[model samples]
Target: MALPPRQSCVDHEEISLGEIKIKTKDPACMCEVEVAPQHCSVDIKSVVIPIYLKFVDVRCSIRFKTSTLCRGSSNIVGKEILHGVSGAVGPGQILAMMGPSGSGKTTLLSLLAGRSQTNLHSGSITYNDMGYTKALKRRMGFVTQDDVLFMHLTVKETLRYAALLRLPKKLSRQEKIQRADSIILELGLDKCKDTIIGGPFERGVSGGERKRVCIGQEILIDPSIIFLDEPTSGLDSTTALRILQLLHGLAQAGRTVITTIHQPSSRLYHMFDNLLLLSNGHAIFFGRGQDALPYFSSIGLNASLLMNPADFLLDLANGNISDTSIPPELEIKLIQSKGDSKVGKPPELAVQEYLVECFSSEVAFRDSSVDSPPHAKDVILPPRREWSIGWWQQFLVLMSRGFKERRHEYLSWLRVFQVLVSAVVAGLVWLHSSADSEKHLQDQVGLIFFISIYWAYFPIFVAIYTFPQERAMIAKERASDMYRLSSYFMSRTLGDLPLNLVLPLVFLLITYFMAHLKLTVGAFLLTVLSLFLIVIAAEGLGLFIGAVMMDTKHATTLASILLLIFMLTGGFFTHGLASFVKWIKYVSYTFYAFRLLIKVQYSRSQVYDCLSATGCKSIASARVMADVDLNEAGPMEDVFALLLMVVGYRILAYVALKRMNTAR
Candidate 1:
């Protein structure tokens, strides 16, 4: 069976920027699709539609400051990485950046995408004659090589959250889902739409499908210009080709797509409409992809028949080309030796200088214009509006996602069993101690300190992994203008509260009755409330540590050291120290929690036979409080301190996250 050739449903006609008029050859067969001035689409058939996108012409000469050790002196010297390298990527075209490592491919893409925070010595990046502002950045998307996704989320759920955060707030929930569905179909991910985006331990979609889902995420925003850094990295050859084909299709649909690729296949090399070849941060070639062969041939470096053009070009760029008369093995050795010799300059440096000179005389350079098209004058881009949803809405969405992620990650059966076992062990150790016995006072105090330590230590250690694990995702989403950092931080802090409180509540429930300290309802409730506050304070401390360190190992080590210091000074291991050092207990939340637990359990009680061997005596709870050096600090005062610590640490965490993100 043969498939029918697709026919155009509408007559081709040129439309101006503000006005679009479509004339159909057959009215009955055509689907009438209205177009908006801000964005327009012409439906060729029910299945194929091309967007009338605003063409973006990007031209920039970017540089960054770097420090190098001085040769003779101990001082550092500053240098520039990029040296005014410039090029343009026009609309409906795929501009592929190819070069060796450290060739500034990713740096150039970051600069063009307006995501770099490094110093720009001099450059101007404009879209359709307008300056590249925050407005334009929101309309563009940059997909990093590494896919940062919520592994617990399904493909559809992932796209839905992306749409909810990135799409205009005016869109209804159903509309956003529909948009996500459309993108899923376009990316050919409909089959795996229901599958979870699994991680190292879980089985789910293939690598190719995951990459497509990443692309689908960006496409949900309907960006006019898209930048991808090594989208084919870590994929098989067949998968890489399929990904390139998808990018090519997007370009054909009127998107200005730019990507950095390394060592592409021959078939993949031909897919690019334009090529930006670079060497040592210098432009070797920037023109049509087809012109590369002729350009190289004219320079007496013609590629052999059936040779991969990309490899040959890279070889030429890297100064590894050999004459036909020279043996290939000897030529490689000679090139290696030349690179090793450090007398005058490396072979690559000489090659870069030669290419830089040759590029000045290339026909592409002589004929190419870095100016915007004339039609850009009449084109009216829509006024830029906020791309994020409302604050409360962002909170709700992030809260939902956080809950789902924690449910899968932190609330496992192993975690539950560990908590239960620890609680049972603590209960057995301090099984039904009397509050009025002076001999049992130490045991009761130990039990209270252990309970405080359990609540404080585990939550802090568990939360140490929170920010580091999500740091990449936070950077990606923040770069995409998805939501405010405050909303995300607040929602995550609030959302995890329930789960954080659950284990502590369970531990207290088992220990409270088994130890049999206080039977009054008010006392039990106060104890529970105080323990909850302590857990929150511990969580905040963990968040602060994670945010400042941004590395799991470093944060965990620092947190362990800090927690150990707090535990030592928590009024359990030591009774009295120098006044100068005794103030350390004031800073430890464990001190307050332990003191409050003791006061709540033994307040208004009395202990008989306090004397060791001289005489019998009766001791009041107030005297016991004075003996512990907590007479001045009541239960309410400790509670207040714990509450303050919670708010203070969370605020500090927020500040740290903002600073780190800004620095990045």
Candidate 2:
């Protein structure tokens, strides 16, 4: 692609500032959502930002001491999404980052939120006292485009999860609940406190409601600074305005709220007290929103459209340099403005403070006279206590949702049902011929094939479905440091168990008896082992797919192809063929697993010892395997290898997941 052009500045005549007058209609209004451009205007004679230390406390200030490359600077030539853009936002103010859809607005938000810390080709970011990205991250909370919520959880549970995971134990339980409840009410989600924030499949609340819950979850953390990336992206204009209004309130209460928005409605356009305009990953304007037009006019860049100036800025940001020309005076204006040190507060605090002030202006809101702690009410609950509940708690939750999500569709269920039916058919076909040594081999092969199909295919299927859903939550939570990735992996793995165990175990047990595949107790135990291996391996497999492919359909496809390759290459299906593709058999997880488990079925080693010690017995009465031949190679070695395979692949899967890191 061609590069952004470096054009001469428009070199416009500077207008005298003595005639400029400030508008003052609504003194109470600042950057509130409802504030109009006409309601509040600053005098042109002085800087809107005066150097203030308090501003340093609330806004994470990013500054480049040297002059920055503007929209068409000759020194700037790269495809970087976010250029050396510097701006500031403090407590109780709104700094709406306005740019086109892809002008690195979200990218800049991500950086400010400390979600990602890749060093800029140049610049410095300071949050509170910390200069590095790491320190800034700890004090900041970020909300992304995707709301990472557990659909199975109620609003209360979701908030509770975040609280427990985020806040240190020093905080009292009451405080956490109060904190959570406050966020719920603050976000205007009190009415849906018990509702589930559902997804496309799990119908519950509206998209806007779910989006609010996401913001609420982050709010519960009560960070010193909160950064939201496109906080109002997907909602309707009214809903979006309401959400922004809620954020404005949050800012007024001494919280810092920095968010990115694109082509906002005219009403939303004027809501920003401070605007950071970016084009081509470069800053064009970084000051009051209304000043945008004058900045353009000063640059001699034409912007006659009645639409939001953000749109005009965005077009200039993403458009071809050849078609666009930067006015000379605009560059000088941007360069001059770059030196202003103080940035304003987050607008969220203003709204929040306004509400607090409105309600408590007359009464002592903080005094005990306002309201005492309410008395606790008795309630009957489940007999099972929370302490004793182990992974089983998660297991039940995951299993219930998995079944509900999968069971409703004929298309989904058919895949599961077909496997079960195939198992039954195989059992009936192989049952009558499996007492002799050759028959024993056939029986072993039957079990291996059936088990391989289940283990190989099921994990891929689950991975395909579960990864996309989990990714949203994982990425969001990971960015927040809600929990360690290992913790999440453990919980999710444990949670999916009860459901995963049932299918493979049920099919194998029923089929085993019907096929009469060496009914030794040892074989039965191995059957359980086989199930465990498959399920765990399958989980690992699914994780690999999910981590590598963000798109579920693509992940599913990749997983399926991998499964086919591994299963076909498994020695059980075509043992002699392995000479040509022997490496394949070695790598095939199913091959090793099924071979190991099937050997146990065929050998009945434990049963053989018992029978031999008794000097054997009549075949009919003893029901011992006649082919417990000493000449046969034992399945013990194969079984151990399979067990190792499970461990090996599981570790590999975890490594893949870690490598496919999230924004953090």
State the lDDT of candidate 2 residue by residue for 1-664, as single tens digits: 1112213112231222222111212233121122234332222211121111111111122333343557543343334565456666666668888766666777667665656545443454444323433433334567887676666667876776566565544456566677777778777788888877666777777778888887887666444467788878888999888888878876766567788887688778877777876654556566677877675555455655465566666665554223334555444434444544364433322322322232233221121211211110111122321221234433343344445443333134665587688778877776644544433445545555776677767666765556576676667766665556565565555556666666677677767788776667887887787767666676777776676676888987787787788878765555456366667767766766665554565543322222344563222222222212322567666566666765665566567678766734
lDDT of 1 by residue, 334-361 (tens): 5765766665556556556666667766
- Worst 10-residue lDDT window for candidate 1 reads 44-53
Q: What is the C-alpha lDDT of each candidate?
A: 0.74, 0.57
What candidate 1 gets wrong by more than 4 Å, as runs, is 1-74, 323-342, 364-371, 379-385, 606-634, 662-664
> lDDT at 607 for candidate 2?
27
Name model 2 segments beyond 4 Å from true.
Answer: 1-84, 172-178, 293-420, 423-448, 464-469, 518-525, 541-569, 573-580, 583-587, 604-635
lDDT of 2 at 530: 70
Q: What's the lDDT for candidate 2?
A: 0.57
Q: Where does candidate 1 clash, by residue pair?
A: none
